[model samples]
Target: MKLIIGGAFQGKKEYAKQQFSLQEDQMRDGKEADFEELFRVPCLYHFHEWIQKGLKLGWDFDGITERLLQENPELILISNELGYGVVPMEAFDRTYRETTGRICTKIAAESQMVIRVVCGMGMVIKNA
Candidate 1:
């Protein structure tokens, strides 16, 4: 698996596409993808939004990263960095932010490659 992350509008998606030679249809938008689609899709963007939805729906995220790694070892995930700025006032907001960070951290540790995009440029932070 691989991870591409950056702040919103940082062109992570474009970079991932160009870097991997992926087409639009080959990537799935996490916001609307079915739960089962995650394991089947080659790439998934807007992953943070999908996590938020799962949290709101009381879905257990435990072992999900592991499942993805096992089921789709070649998957490329794109998520917006959400750990910056002031803390949120709402409890749910805080949970969502922290959950996304923790999950991304886990994914990064196991990913064969991890890239951070900024201003449409990709900086490879990790490469196996």
Candidate 2:
């Protein structure tokens, strides 16, 4: 199984579904279904918690990596890429941007392929 991890609104997830012929409203099928179910259940709290944990204690990042290999599932996890750019001036903005970078790092590390979608265009980052 293979997966993509990038950023929010990067078309990562969309491309995955399209590649699999998955309907917009339809759930995933095949061996990957269980992994996909992670997004189906309501996020316990602020969805951002997942990202923060990744940067702070590597909880989110490590967890995702374990799941990917354990399930050997095809995946596409989107994130907001915020590094290699400006430093956020506000606290909340800084948190969001920082966490985005951490999560992206984790996801890309496990990705067999990676792409950076900017201005609606996806630039392949690895093994395109």
> Over 4 Å off in model 1, which ranges?
none
lDDT of 2: 0.50
Segments of candidate 2 deviating more than 4 angstroms: 1-20, 26-62
Question: Each prediction's TM-score against the native?
Answer: 0.98, 0.53
Per-residue lDDT for 5 in model 2?
39
- Alpha carbon lDDT of each predicted model: 0.94, 0.50
Q: In candidate 1, list every pair of residues with a backbone clash.
A: none
What RMSD value applies to candidate 2?
6.7
Judging by TM-score against the true structure, name the best candidate. 1
Q: In lDDT terms, which candidate is top? A: 1
lDDT string for model 2 (1-128, tens) is 23343445666546655554555555332223333454442211122334554445433444766665565445445444556567878886687676656655665677677765554556677863
